[model samples]
Target: MATSNSRSCLKYLLHLAHDNLDFRLPEITALLALRGKPFHPCENFREKAPFWCLNDLSEEDVHSIMTRSICAKSAFELWGHGQTHSELKASLLNYPPENMSPFTHKDSTYRINVYTFNKTLEFADRIKRIDALEYLSFEGTVSLKSPQHIFCLLEDYGTDPNNIPEQPNYIYFGRWIADGQRELIRSHSVKNRHFIGNTSMDAGLSFIMANHAKVKENDIVFDPFVGTGSLLVACSHFGAYVCGTDIDYNTIHGKGRSSRKNQTWRGPDENIRANLRQYGTEKMYLDVMVSDASKPVWREAALFDAIITDPPYGIRESTRRTGSNKDITRPPEESHIPVSQAYHLSDIFADLLNFSAHHLVMGGRLVYWLPIYRPEYCDEMVPHHPCLRLISNCEQTLSSHTSRRLITMEKIRGPEEVDRLAHLADLRFSPYQGHNAFREKYFSGLNKREGEDV
Candidate 1:
């Protein structure tokens, strides 16, 4: 029965969704460390899996843990835990946090959780603020770690109160909790960013911040592939000084019908004007540019506190390298560009890791979306980089064209400090490649032909 602070211990069962389970351990560890408390990775790993025991923890603590856990690296989404085992489920419901207190529930602490069950979250009500006694259906209930308190603390440290919302329900709980329902419960900085864009928000980015990047006032956040400036918007909502860049200006600035489209051509100045107005950014222009991510010359050394990005898929619209004098309109005769022919995306990702390591302080993190075709390609690119460690890869469903891979890397003692780097590169890439059921289905239809033959 360990205690975190004034509060005692509480047990939470986090059933992580497949590969995302990898982030659970690191996410919890990061949050605890930020709160002036640190938990051992090996011991805390249990709390991320089948059942996690967070002794003397608050709702904000849990929320941050879930945020980062879902974010990859240090964050992730909650699948149902313990309950997967019927016997465990029966005992867990009775062990809700409300029933116990810091004094009485020392060892057998109460746990609160909101999980994705059959697509929808089971305890969306209990996620934000936890009072062991309040049922999920009630109103005005707050998790012991109130976000308002966290906001106040940020304010005392010179954060903008305008960044903090009036309502609690506006916060995020992934897509499991519907928007309207979330508005009814709590208001969150992450939710504001998710609703601004036309497409579904990048869950990987949301997951990582929820875990690793602690939102202090004026904390600088950057994303090289600032697609619609989603990460910046999210960080700004959370009181961070956000900077982002992209090769395309039209996607950021074009207004009206054209602004709504992606590949249309536009200029950097126009994009900057539209973005500044759209996100209500005033006085200072966003530290954005149309620069290439592979080149580290754009900004000074050790400038950003955090880095997050989603690189382009080679399968889509061709991203021709600049300084070219080739044909103006028709497609290039060659399908593949030589490594020297163009800035290889694999190299961009590896470079992103290296550059972030140089800019980020120790314990800083970088979240990037890696498309998995040949895992070996990614492994080879970042193989022995001392500046970062590949923490986790959360499998996601992006578009029809690309296979989503949410990769989280941390700055651990630089590349020179890395003792060893290994990963379970084994992925069921084809979705149903080696399953027995798939094999049986394909063979069964062909094997049973005319009924009489042997």
Candidate 2:
């Protein structure tokens, strides 16, 4: 029997998808962190590469990672790797014979797959490559349709379409383990979803945010600025109890203009809860309310395990919060609700950070997007709080001069009075404080070109 000791110190090969390169590391790291494992990449680790060899992980750990990773395509148990096929053979030979016996045993049925990155091999050539591996004695019966065990020979042709190399830059051989949850992206696509908004989060990105927050089974997840509960849908799929609040009554009630091209209006059944029900995650649905994020109504306690949101940046949706020029001490009556004025970009972030600090459990994460005018943005401009420690800031460029950063932060300490008031008193947020400041900056270049035409 293959024992835990036999799996110890064995390296794992991650076959990551080429897209969403920026979000890959943090997603994998956060998933591993949930399992109490630190990321230990093997030698010559390239963060941008399609393949990553990881050490200090067991087969179970790899399985756990594959369950949650959207940025990854598949995973394998790395038996050998080298700069060349000859070197790969030497490495495979050096591998302990005892480790090879279990898979190559006479009773087993197996098959080999040849996967090449950045290049494709002809069928005959692929057959020739597999035939070259005859040096490794295999006593198992060949089974192509359904195999008990599978091995793979992976070739890394340097990632350049223009300059195709005659030889592969690297080669890896491994035992197939598990595939990642790439199917989730297609299954949970917003195009197929029951409810969607103009700025509903993309299904892939929603799952990435949930992974970044380390959302797990039975965990409570919240989205303060929820729009059709896209992030909540992703969180609920991972077995988390999901709820959210939106200031837009139409959105909260799912009774608004349809974002679909041909659809005139949403049906009565159209709602966030219905979205969960469509995905068979209705049990994970808590509730969504029409409430202001700035003036949070939740009790003063850590009630959520993760807070994931995508605040409106005044492009697809307008940013507004309840208030008026007139100063009224008491609450407004039911007859006349307060008018919503422009909520500043700076204050939106300030309120979000403060709210997260107060509401998220210790070590729980706050994942959200921060819009940036690319030229004016610096690391210092990322909002900070004493209670929340900034984790990762990844960019998804929108235009030549504008991009939004996905920022992940973990709550380290409970809020202090000093921490709650920091953003209000800080001088750093002055640049984008104006309600239309970011909006104006985002459109300046476009307007300039239009004026040039005029």
Candidate 3:
């Protein structure tokens, strides 16, 4: 019975998890964009707040976002909200009854849940709070076990735990819509995965990277530094056709010693293809191979829709590429032996960006992590390319002195758009020179901390 005017003005509420605060906006925005919707926040929106009010989104849009979101815990169809309980009541009264009657009808069963952020309430107080909502005309029977409709009264007690307030800083009333895919974190955890390397990405972060890249069904996704194909697994779950390349032969063949405790050698079936089968996404697996990221293996055409990967930080893994010392004599072709030299962090990022620039289709995205030394970190330190535009850079701190940033870039123009000579002439287009010393700075900080402890 809702009027067209009222339905058009309806707003949705998102209750986001506090962890990974920096990645929330980008994740939600990308999800909304997937549905051809723009991120339109209501007035006085706070990015850091646990609750977010979004306007101009349909119920279908909300459902779509919930199906994919890992940062958002749950979403709701907001009925009312205000700075105080009394104000909340006033706001609820102003909501159109025609829009509310279907769920609150006489035959329907419903339940009211009280959720408080940053504070815990006594059982008695929680009961009192729910009982106070009697002002709304809910003709439905109270069914806690299985309700047709669920309403929630959420209270925000500010983020500071030390200075808890007597009353909530804000209150919201909404009908619960759907919960996010946070359960994927536990279900796909690397600890439980069949094939994992020392630096296998966390399942939660791998999914987040796929989301940031806007990986969608049937899209071809690739990872150049695919170690154990963690990123590929996340993309395959989203219905993408995934493939990747790595320089290590043992890793590509899954013939190395096992990383798990009490295990010696890897099982014969312990491989990237088997990982996709474990998650029932084997159909989406294209292939993986042993190839250096610095070398061009693919044809000179844009082949990938998205590139999501976690490059080595040179901590647990060594950054090496196929190379030989300039002074070393070359062996005969028949008796040639493969040799590897150090791959500088700066050059790694440069090759990654350049590779993505040529191989990613126009509008395709590349999402990867860049290690940073906190003391010398700057925006300029992020590698850039003319054909690709920087989208988002989110920081995930590892320790007091070291952190890695998740960098997302979208290819806006094809390689033909820029002159080859000019692109190389620009110093900014090169890899950040400072990154070459990151390994030194990282260890220096660790040594300084050790000295302090003594």
TM-score of each: 0.53, 0.96, 0.96
Instruction: State the local distance difference test value for candidate 2.
Output: 0.90
Which run of 10 residues does model 3 get worst, by summed lDDT? 416-425
In candidate 1, which residue ranges exceed 4 Å CA deviation? 1-28, 39-51, 56-60, 63-216, 255-285, 325-341, 374-384, 397-402, 413-454
- Between which residue pairs do clashes occur in model 3? none
- Across 393-440, the per-residue lDDT of candidate 1 in tens digits comes to 555543232245666677786443232221113232222122212223
Candidate number that wins on lDDT, 1 or 3: 3
Candidate 3 lDDT for residue 61: 93
Kindly list the per-residue Cα lDDT of model 2 for residues 405-454, writing each as its tens digit: 99999999999888878876666655546434788888895687578789
In model 3, which regions exceed 4 Å deviation?
1-8, 327-337, 417-424, 427-431
Tell me the deviation in Å of residue 239 in model 3: 0.3
- Best-to-worst order by TM-score is 3, 2, 1
Q: 98-120 in candidate 3: lDDT tens per residue?
A: 77887898999999999999999
